[model samples]
Target: MSYRRKHTAQTFITNALALLFIFLFIYAGLSKLIGMSVFKDQLSQVPLTTQAAPFLAWAIPTVEVLVVVLLLWPSLRRWGFFSFLGLMLVFTGYLIYTLYFSPYTPCSCGGVISGLSWRSHILFNLFFIGLAVLAILLVPSKSLEKQQ
Candidate 1:
């Protein structure tokens, strides 16, 4: 393929991936924001989460919404990608922590996906993070250098 064709294909893929991430994040975030009881119910299934459940119940969804907003903008897409990756890393850490230190199995996340083992949760977030990273890398930088 010519350079232009390759660039177009990459851009299409990146935009599609971003849209998918944005949709899922926004939906999940709205679900959390709309129903605290549902979130609390899900939290009860996880052990350590019970302690910090309230804060996370409110915070996670809010952050996800913000990340989606940022990712949708051209100027802010890089920041969004970085923020998303960071959040996913934190999520991975939480899953790992729950798996090893907490006594209870992780609860269903947001009542959307059910019965995800801690390992599965980590891998899922890792996969999304990887996709976000790839999308960020594919985005064209604004600056250009003139040949000497």
Candidate 2:
């Protein structure tokens, strides 16, 4: 394909990925907000995160919403992709920790994700992480474009 066609395709792919993240965050964040009690309670059961659970309980959804807002603007899409990737990485790390180290870890994640087995959840996170990475790669950098 020509550079223009390829660029357009990549842009479409990246935008689609961002839209997916937007939907995921809105759905998950709203679910967490709706079930605040259950989410906070489950977080309290975790061993290492017990103390921080209260803060994280609110912070997670807040950040998710913030990132979604950033993703909506073309100018801020790069930041959104980075922020989304970081969140997914942290989530994946926790899942890995829970899967191997924590003997009786409870799922505090809101919505349908709470139903996923630890192993399946890890896979799920990996998939989203992949999408974030793809979005990051496909987003054209203005400076680099000019140099080329």
Candidate 3:
């Protein structure tokens, strides 16, 4: 109810969300990097992705780490949000594609995160996409007058 309380509440929410994003990205990236055998196994589970599995295992983690770094910086954070949004959308699309096109379900996503069914996968992507959108929307825009 108090002005100070409201500001504190808003700051808490923003920082919490940022921390969540940072943790998830870094953890997942490390999982992929350190668990290559598991990552490969998960990728091989998808019929069409078998050939692409190796490349993705290496690439995804690198991109994720970069995104995490970008998101941590105040100035470059929008690019991070945008990149994450795109990545999540692509992942959601992959899940949909695999659900309908692939003969077998890919059990290789990488441990707990990878084992999710198509529906859960879509929901997962949507959750992050929502977060990225919220982050972008909440980011403050500075004016030239403020700079001077």
For this target, which candidate reaches the highest TM-score against the unseen true structure?
A: 2
Tens digit of lDDT per residue, candidate 1, span 1-148? 9977887897798688778788878877776777777777667667777787778787788899899998899688778778877887887787787778877764546545445666777788888888878987877666621221
Q: Order the candidates by TM-score, highest first — what do you get?
A: 2, 1, 3
Better of 1 and 2 by lDDT: 2
lDDT against the true structure, per candidate, is: 0.76, 0.88, 0.76
Total clashing residue pairs per candidate? Answer: 0, 0, 2
- lDDT ranking of the models: 2, 1, 3
Lowest-scoring 10 consecutive residues by lDDT in candidate 1?
A: 139-148
- Identify the runs in model 1 with alpha carbons over 4 angstroms from their true place: 41-51, 144-148
Q: lDDT value for candidate 1?
A: 0.76
lDDT of 3: 0.76
Q: In candidate 1, which residue pairs get closer than 3 Å at backbone N, Cα or C atoms, i.e. clash?
A: none
The candidate, 1 or 3, that scores higher on TM-score is 1
Best by lDDT: 2
